[model samples]
Target: MAETTGGVIDAAERDLIIRSQAGDRAAFGKLVEQHMKRAYFAALGFLGSHDDALDISQEAFARAFDSRAKLDPGRPFYPWVYQIMRRLVFNISRDRKARGAKLEAATGWIVDDLSARALREGPAARLERSELEERLHGAIAGLADQEKEVLVLKEFEDLKYREIAELLEIPIGTVMSRLYSARKSLAKRLEGVV
Candidate 1:
């Protein structure tokens, strides 16, 4: 069977893409519903604010839909969407640099329930854990942009070294080195706190 332009072209998403390309607003809406959360989360992780995430996510889908005909039929869709998102983040970072704005903390360290439980043995322990999360986030914010990007992609997004290299257009070795440095720096910073 022939594949469609939306990549791997599952029945539902393929139908939606086809309808969307043909100017079906409802189909496009459905497409947004399917992908928006993932897109928003990716953007939030990169850009670090709800407002910026909203703008970046909306821009990415709009750009994707506008250029729908160029999308490959055999690849996964999220990678393409993520590329758009990364471009938006780079642009945002550039603008912030031009305006002399410092990189801000994207969010608190995302401790899962198990990690939280392990850290929080009592009320005082929980408070101490929260303070550590804040300090860790501050340390992350202090990292170089490339280092921070590498860490977030590898740890939070669970991207492989090669995947991160491709996403950031760096060599795999560079990704590994940056991740190593980031982890070492974070560990040193969080040593006594956590």
Candidate 2:
């Protein structure tokens, strides 16, 4: 019953949402299984540490379940759960900034998928790739959180502008504007290297 542009989740998902809203833990578990990885990665893109992402994603689900009564059956579940996760991410990020703690660069979160290709390269090529990744990560880390969030949703999550707008509860124009700013900033940061 979660209304969507195409169709409120398909029958199975809608059924799970209904059951979850009815206090069915197993149904909620199923929903978690469907979304856990994407949720974790989204948090990873924000927090930059595997452990923190894992903890925040799990905690978000816990909060979501605790507030199950507020879940609208006519809405997609991930976005609701995402709002919880995003708040947790922003809170921790703000705390870290206040404490002057820099985010640690986790080895695998962002660049692991390229490992096979990297392995085939010579040491010099691999080193160059590693350096580029480091610079890119540093540049992304320097972005304002709002710009970073929009960039992550569009680039890493591969969500379309409309989807990103819906997820962030912003207008499509805002999503485009933020994305443009993020990309422009990155381009300037990476101008010489790339």
TM-score per candidate, chains pooled: 0.73, 0.89
Q: Give Cα-based local distance difference scores for all models.
A: 0.73, 0.84
lDDT of 1 by residue, 1-194 (tens): 31211235566666666777778889878878777887787776666677888999999999988887776544546667778877888888778868877545444424556347846598787777677767776677666667877888787778788777766667899999998998889888888885
Specify the highest-lDDT model's number: 2
Poorly placed runs, candidate 1 (over 4 Å): 1-15, 98-120, 162-171
Tens digits of lDDT, candidate 2, 17-67: 899889899999998998899899999898889999999999999999999
Provide backbone clash counts, one per model. 0, 4
For model 2 the local lDDT of residue 82 reads: 90
- lDDT for 79 (candidate 1): 68
Which consecutive 10 residues in model 2 have the weakest lDDT in total?
1-10
Give the Cα-based TM-score of candidate 2 against the true structure: 0.89
